[model samples]
Target chain A: MQHLLATHPRRRLFQLSPPATKPSREGVFFLPSIRIGLAVLALGGLGAGSLALAQEPPAPSPERSRELIRMVRQDCGSCHGLTLRGGLGSPLLPETLRDKPPDGLKHTILLGRPGTAMPPWKTFLNEAEADWIVAQLLRGFPEESK
Target chain B: MRKALRAWCWAILAFLPLLAWSAEPTLRGTGDLGVIIERSAGRVLIVSTSSNSIISKVEGLGDLSHASVVFSRDARYAYVFGRDGGLSKVDILRGTLEKRIVQGGNSIGGAISQNGRLVAVANYEPGGLKVFTADTLEPVADIPAAYGDNKLSKVVGIADLPGDRFIYSLFDADQIWIADLRDPKAPKVEKFSNIGKAPYDGLVTPDSRHYMAGLFGEDGIALLDTWQPEQGVKRILANYGRGEEKLPVYKMPHLRGWAVAGHQVYLPAIGRHEVLVADTIHWKETARIAVRGQPVFVVARPDGRQVWVNFAFPDNGFVQVIDTLSGKIVQTLEPGKAVLHLEFTPRGETVWASARDDHKVLIYDTASFAKLAELPADSPSGIFFTSRAHRIGF
Candidate 1:
């Protein structure tokens, strides 16, 4: 199963290609089943990558994740605006980030953008943690608890 | 014998009120007061400069990320500019918020007119500046920062001049505009374009004669003579960082933090771990003192004998004191984590520093370099003293 997941050329092509277009008329009948299969394949690919990236970033605990969220809202928010709308730094809203890839955003968080006010957070956050932050930012940041 | 004792007791009781009156503590005047910004909590802690103690806490300010405060002429009121564009008029004496207005979407800071009647805010969003009445904060004049082809530019480094005028640098357009507020309703603007690239922040000289803007895109400062507006702009220290490898700047060095002591002005060397000492008269770099980190605020004491400097992240915990005469790091002290700002008392007897991560404001004796006192704060950053009221563009 692992080998099949790793060597699947069609799945690799789907992952590398731009977002897929509408299915052809001949493939329309099997579209629903194909979609389900693709979803499973994508999940498998994520798992494979998780195992391959040198050392996987531990899934942040609930409390740790909450702290990270607050840090982004307050600390990063210093330059990025409290609402993350935009200030001295550019906006970080989901819409503004639709074109930005998740990996690229994560790299920016870890290494920081040179010649700008964005400082590298590698000392404070791990690669996986940065990935988590990018994911949350893309899906709309969480609000602090009252 | 009983009658005599009773008379004695009555006499002592009569003098008690007089003694009590003599021992009563005198009220602190507004001039002896100062404010410390609590960054995360959206609050300002009013403190007594004499005793170095927190007097009161004014709360409910919006976003204090890059917050700054300027005092009214009487020093009774404080105008706080928040990053979220909230302009709050805090009465320092009454320990209350008099008025607050959301002037724009984002703002770096603001300046009060020399006469203390008009307040001008430098805005990032919607890209313009808005002047308001100092007393009521009522909108007076709206100046859209449009450059070429109706392009709006974010305003930075808005400072007040001696002649009821305000000067500001356009961040995106690379221009400087001096607004004459002799008539608050209608300001006559004198624009100087193509001054420099990316004038991030600026400050007016203590004499209010020279207006210098720090350029981020280049390794120099743009200077304009307020006295000679027709001379256009001059670039100073153009090659200060030439042949040196530039470091990543995690934070922008504030030109307001540059200090003039004696014949020299101390400026934070951009993208370098040093403070450049430049001659005010010659406008040339004389020497540079290596520091622990990228210099943030290089402020001189009121007496002009010593200058204290803070650093950017990773080395923000340390502060170095430079003796102006020696042009060297005389002393280095670690106040605490993230020492964001430093402010001197009216007489320069004491300096107040805020350590944001440690949640404390440390007071140090200027002469002895000893810790005088520490006040607990919530992520404290900027320490502003009422003595700023006397300065033209504080």
Candidate 2:
């Protein structure tokens, strides 16, 4: 059964990278030094001290991430085009979703809009997973890689 | 020596027609040909159902992730409605795309008129129904599904009715419209509003008399009798959720497949794991047969003896066949992963199922429940046979 997480925001500072250290209770496993460097590179003027205080939610295993990508590509592609350019459903492309808040998008993914054809994915995905999906959709969802 | 060589050549020429006739005497018929949509690859595999083999692959049709196909009246050409709004006319015998045009920004599906003179496309992006001539793919008429302060509604479940008419439902508008294209130049439309909430998809009965649209927001199906339009739309199986908290749907159930066996019609119940069987005489609910997962395509065989079902997302791997005679699950076969679509032979002797993850179309004997053959494909989704050319609202 899929689990749902609370809507509390967990700031994911960097991209999905293999951690050199053991995972923590908060699910932040990447090396602090590397995380800080990448965060600085990504956020431009963000300070390392503030980044250190940011918490990251537990990330899906690499295997599960692959499954999510395939699901988004094929299953979600049924309505949203395989390219995320949209068909019966609205476009999930980065350019279209960039103006939308990531949290709102995550909620939409978890709990679908009531009157629309977009069905809720919460039955098969959790809040963290939905959050990751929204982040990916904002940064351009990855292609299905076998 | 030259005269002797010329005599031998003349003898060979005299028997050339006989040799050719002996090799392939019968003319090729389009009846045994079919097309399979390879979703992610933007290509379609033209296959021969008689040999259960892939004839050729036609490529460059854009963004086929949600593509659907309709056959020409002659069954020689397949008109593919791509999600990217690319309308392509492909000649199956020649294994080539005869013509293609981006009729809209995003399209859901389309249908061919009764006379086969026009093709109507249901678009989502521009929110309208665009009709074109089948021969040249030229624009004939454009009908915008406009509602409420000049806003356009997405058109879904567009199917051709008898007498050169086209029927479709508007998703956002909760309405069904029938366009009379008897004269392709000037089309007349009749509309029925407030039928139900979110008519996701629709289908016409095998006899081409009734058009039913599946409601997404509500628990019923909005059905219209084409023969009696003055009666308006009627709701069947309303509030089927039974006052219980409904389960979240992973994928929207499809109503495009007409599964009317004898007098009973099989429809997938939204947010439920059962196929609701209803009587066609009065359109009343008869029974609900529990099945695996949310039913996607509850399609009946050509003869309407057995109804085949595939599920959504997680339960998509298994396919169940229902014996219409007894209303029981006759066989449950795990064909492969992500079985997106299924199509039966023109005679209903064999059924072909596409496994997107497995990258192959599995052919099964509908009677003996045995595997017949397998053909390779790239993320195959919808398997359409040219036999659809003769059927109404295919």
Candidate 3:
């Protein structure tokens, strides 16, 4: 855990501040180092002074990105509305998500919000994929190609 | 004078054919007419059940990703409730949008009143139920789903009752409310609190006696006897998943497609690859039929001899049919990819299914299980028929 945190000092500070205030997230910090590394990869992918500094793992291929986009459009669209407008679930539009932090959003995608209808997608998605989804969502998700 | 009169008659007769050639409207009945939601295009295909074909298409409905249709009493007009809070009344016969109103910020679905006079919409944003006059889309009343302090709960599972009443469940508040609208200006609402965890969706029995809401936060359903609101909400099929580790649910199972076959009610079990069969007489679980995937919709044929089940993603491409008499998986067929919704013809002779990914609606003969026809639609989802106009809860 010490080595993982030392390697990503900026991310460790940013990620540790939230769990300090939130008692619910305290349990999540004590998990195995592998989970912490994955969480760091997910939350710290876009939080940097420089885009190059953001620790992005191997990017998905062009073909794989399309599948991920379709899954989010149709599967997540089931509750978020096909147009990403609100339905039973809140809207995923840029306007609705602009105020929310990308780190929290990625966490929610990986480990769903407890006591809500949102379910975790960790089984279907990895840390990088969830981070990629959050990045796309923040800047208006792309429409699926016909 | 006789020659002038004959000349005038000749002129009138000459203009009659010209008027006929200019434009003549086609008259038709709406009994067999229905609407299919083109989710991606924000359009609807006005279809005919008698001929099993698409008659025409109407467009300009905003954000139809989760659109639902409820027909007016005459069945000539369909009230389409859109996700972006647009309630459009479409003239199915003329294939035109008659009236539309963006009444809310985010709306889920709606139901027409028992007498077909009022339409009530369930909303998420600024959560509340709004009633409107069926004819002109005029606002009648607004009932906010307000709970403790200033918080509001998103309302779901709205259905019309025998009297001018609408029964719905509150997801955040964990309550079920029945609004009596006999007096449209003033609705009398009866609230039952602490029903259970999140009541995601609801359905009214064919007889209009019971209203059951499927719970997503727990392993049971909240059942309400509409006739006896005083009896309170009862938890049926509680702890059905006590021992098993509930699987990750990719899609939430809908309760609207609930099936009541003979004496048993077939329900889609949440996060489990099974359908729960309960005895309607005592409201007890009699059996649990294992299925291929997590069932989304479990609908019975009109005759109740067969119940068709559709699944969520991963297993969504396949559909299974259950024999009600034997309670066994009779047949399974791969209809198409991303099969979203299903609707049986009024008499159960045929069933129409919408495959969103394939962009086609597949028709099948229920008895022979043979593919009847395939009609092109733009990312189709729900298939609603006009026969729902006369039913209690659609």
Candidate 4:
């Protein structure tokens, strides 16, 4: 680990959602943002410094209901339109996850799926927050939640 | 009613990552690779495939029904390439699907260049390779393949090596293709003659010096020198079937999925339930050890000590485990029903698998080699989990 760190190149690109909206990448395969660091490291096989680029939560209150809607909006909207309608990601606007209980919903949110595009987020969210969002999703998200 | 339920499920899971990941903890690579694991009594499947050592999950993403997945070049971005060509690219760092690009036609396999310049999608039905600009998400070029040439050819897989080029395997056509995307605007397509009757799958060594081609119709692998692609070191049979009589015209005996790690090449053969080995240095046939049945896909560990194999269709659901050193089947994991794909984390700690009909992504302990847990995926195929998860949608 230290070997890679000492040799690691500093990737200037930042996160996957780099400042540039077009999001050019290192190649057709690498996500643009992270590759900046990797490519610099991969340069001459010098493989160096490791870095993780995201914010973790204990999200401040907008209430659990509000956060859930935000989560839904972020997750569903990221690919499907933020409207939660449907795009590459299937539609989620209150119809899909409505039937599953808050518990089951939390499971889906924290544990990213294996075969599908959906990844687990237990590391990204606390159980309580995941549940909170599911509950609010089961019911409704007030405009204030947004 | 079911439609509505399904819709809500998608909505809720989709949104949680947005809220959660936007608020995830900062994680840096500690020189350790991320892997897939199950938590909370196996209900949650966490994939630490992002640059950040965190996971982004979606509810019902691993429902055990059936699911498909695809990953960008570095595994930072993953797309659930689903039925009807549905694609959802995820943010591994955030553990969310941020973009979904619904392709008009059916795509089977895709490859991303090291520079993030191109994403070549191997499409079925339409029978051609569709090239897209990874950065702009625009159609760069669509190379029409000879799929229905007397129905003799069907493009199966596409691979993007270190440089700005790619190699594709044609199903029935005793041929392979190398497309040069030097200009991005004008791609120079070149056909590399096949050494066997049917070249199913192949892999490019990390150095991009040689391409190990697998012949499903023939009884072994064809070792092609990428430098002189038009020519070859000729065919290096993995020694499948009795003696070297070559396969009958109608038979598909080889059945290998080719994959490379660092320097070594792994060839998974169905006939022997063994993984054929080759020294990537010399590109010579090394050894072959038997594993479980019908091993289709082969994935090598980061250090190249082991190669994980996934079996499809028959053989009743098993992941034939191969030991690289001995070139033998170490164990067979029974995941059950139409297992399509297999991959390990960067650190080679966990193994993630997806079953086509089961609609589930099964998690296994790489160290313990146990059936740990499962996640729900929606008609997923060609699964991949990057250490860095970008938000993907579609």
Candidate 5:
């Protein structure tokens, strides 16, 4: 699991902060690492921070990629709508997901949104595979056959 | 005499064509017709239960990802609810699409009123319920599930009740609303906000006396007795897991597929690979039967003699059949890859299951546990039979 997390470029973003020493009245903990990371990036004057953070992961082989694409179109499509138009889950079309950062989408795919029907695919997919899916979704999703 | 015989032969030949026409089967009289949803291909295969053959395949309906169907009272027409919010009325006897309408941006499923006059859909996009005339599919009422400063909540588990009313669970708001469509133009809404947290899905019992909603944010289920609505909702099986960590829920358990056998109800334990048996009289967990994987649909046979269950992804290929009397898994069958849904024949003598990965629908004999036949499908999911016309919620 650790190895899989390392392959994700945005892993550091989630791991930036350490666990809170105490919980608040509402039982929610605030992460200070995110503020520190933002300060560091601002001081470095890196306007292309998002692009730098989205470092491409190791690509899957062509055959393996095709299999992953089919899984997304059929299995993932079960809830996301076969056409990616949205059903129980939100739409996955490029237009609907255009504003979402690629790295964020990758993180979501790896560690599903808690309290929702989305289940983390880290058990079934590697970080690299999830990155591939995010990239495909940003563009147009592939057809099931060709 | 020869000339007279020739004339008679010609007359008999002319009558032969009329005889063949009369011998053709009538659409309305044909019993046990069902529909198999081809999810990816946007088509539905109309199958005859008695012959176990494909009657016809209706096409052009769009985005059947989470498609569901409800039958008309006469069992002649099937109203298919597509994921793209396309409501289509299909004539089972004619094996053709009668009427189609795009009601919403995205819909999960729908229910037909007890009187068979209205069809209501639960939508997620705009977050509301839409009711339409059962015959013409005309818009009757639009009830936006608004709560707390005009915020909309996605509707789930909408089922028709006895009094021309529809009950649905709100996934986002964590409430249940009963919409009385006594007058198709205006519906009286009764909101039960204190039901529980994140009521994912719900279903009305076969007798239509109780409505139960499964909670996602908490353990246990919320129960409402329609006969005694003023008493409010009762929580049942509150500590099902007993503080133990639950297995990660791959997919939300669907209460619509829960089964009732005799005086007991069989339900899929959320996030767990077990089927929980609850007594209808006491509304308490009686027994938990371990199964192969996370149970998706724990459907009871028509006779309520046995219950069939299918699992979630990775373990989706296997199906387990349990004997209701003994509360034990009697047999296990592999119906191929990505087995999504199951439906039983009118008499519950046979079961039909769809394998999405294999692109085939398998039918098995319930009593003998034998493979009966297989029909080729395209990424099939839900198998709905016309017999649903007789049930409370389909």
Candidate 6:
């Protein structure tokens, strides 16, 4: 169980400012799916962070894949802009990040490279969750477009 | 403990999709000084000055998505205007919603009359200006017009003057209509060709001599001398393009405003992190103060001594306070989530803000400009004070 920790409006507002948009989508501020998951992790407890990693939509099961699409729209919609079209981050669809392997995707999620707004989620997620998130990216939300 | 963590992860996986499906991106507008407004909790919020960790929130106002707030002539009452077509007259001194009257119809904004005896609300549904006796809050009249061919025919801004005096803008039609209210019961209206664009936001001077409307596409704000409608209107200044062209990489031209105060006008350049200040007296470009991120709103202090600007960038949503005289950003407050609209107390002592990212209205102390408390707001657009003039039995 997670303790109800009181959130300080000033501190987090200053430190964890949400990126307005994705710098990649032709300068439109859009958020990627993984980033949306990471933002939710920040709002959750230490266990929730791991939970986010584990629940990283696009489960091996079909039911989970449907949910992954929802996560991309809702959780990632804040800084990513609505529609998951990509704002401040690169496009997640295969066409956008083509030729990249799952390990490459996992590496980016786990050890988020420096010199970029991306943050390392190694501490927040276990290996399983990272892989699951990668699976959805590979499959793309078109499989479950609303 | 490890087992417990594992189980929790399992549970989260089950509900992750549902949770993500409902979350929405927060919207904020930077106003006058260091003020911001957004939908948080369930009320309209206002945070003034920068030093606050939390902003003061006014609850039970309305949906932030379809509502807006404006000040009375005296800046004593903040009229919370909503889409259900209602206005929540709030008393800033008493910290309460004085009264809630069904006002406006998909209206652009609300205005108080010159004598403060009556209040007028613009509604989009029926596309007309609704007048109410300020004191009784009774529907006095439904001023109709030939709305033209506007697809979104909501009255955008309103200014009350002398001689059956009132002026309002229609968004879809891109026109400004003047109504002579010398006799509140029967008024005469004359519509003019819009100087620039539609959906313009403007303010009437304290003396009610002129109305200044800010255009979105035009490079600057426009002025209409309401004193004599027959003399026609004057385009005070236009083509206020972004001054910086040296760094093609960094140069951007912007000329637009969300709100105006006294003789000073404040607006944001979408391409830059700064708000431009214009002097209504000289009617010339005055100054531009750099802000943190994306600026959406600008509002002025009651006394017009200070102007605050808020940002929209997640981290860029800090508040910047400017000394009106010098036109320089003097203090910067890191209130989370760029602000949209903010309001000041009667005495101008406290500042309240609405935050979208933080999901709450954070209040701050004006003295030290520090955060004090947080109030739950649904979608606080902008903060406004109650009408000191309304209390006199309007």
Which should have the higher DockQ, number 1 or number 5?
A: 5
Between candidates 3 and 4, the one scoring higher on DockQ is 3
B66-94 per-residue lDDT for model 6 (tens digits) = 34555555554566665445577765434
At residue B34, what lDDT does model 2 achieve? 97
**TM-score of model number 1:** 0.84
Docking class of 2: acceptable
TM-score of chain A of each: 0.60, 0.62, 0.61, 0.47, 0.59, 0.45
lDDT, candidates in the order shown: 0.81, 0.84, 0.84, 0.52, 0.81, 0.53
Better of 3 and 6 by lDDT: 3
Q: What is the C-alpha lDDT profile of model 3 across B1-394, one tens digit per residue?
A: 9999999999999999978876867666898889999988889999998898999999999789878999999999999998878899999988899999988877769999999999999987668899999999999999999999988888899999988899998988999999999999989999999999989999999999999999998999999988787898999999999879788787888777549989899999999999999998899999999999999999999899999999998899999999999999998988899998889998999999999889999999999999999999988999999999999987
Q: Model 5, which residues run further than 4 Å from truth?
A: A1-59, B1-30
- Separate clash counts for every candidate: 0, 0, 0, 108, 0, 72
TM-score of 2: 0.86
- Across B218-249, the per-residue lDDT of candidate 4 in tens digits comes to 57676667787657536775456657432111
Q: Write the per-residue lDDT of candidate 1 for residues B179-295, one digit (tens) a residue.
A: 999998878999999998889889988888999998887788899988999999999989788878787676678888439888888888888998888899989999989989998
Candidate 5 residue-wise lDDT, B17-88, digit = tens: 988888986435545788999988889999988889898999988878889999999989989998877899
lDDT per residue (tens digit) for residues A1-146 in model 3:
32232233234344432211212211122124233433454356433221222333344566777788788988999987776665677777544565677789999999988777788889889998898788567545667767
Residue pairs with backbone atoms closer than 3 Å in model 5 (clashes): none
What DockQ does every candidate get?
A: 0.21, 0.34, 0.33, 0.01, 0.25, 0.02
Question: Comparing to the true complex, what docking class would candidate 3 get?
Answer: acceptable
Native contact recovery (fnat) for each candidate is 0.44, 0.72, 0.78, 0.00, 0.58, 0.00
Candidate 6 chain B: 10-residue stretch with minimal lDDT: B246-255
Q: Interface root mean square deviation of every model, in Å?
A: 10.0, 7.6, 9.2, 18.7, 7.9, 14.4
Q: Which residue pairs in candidate 1 collide?
A: none
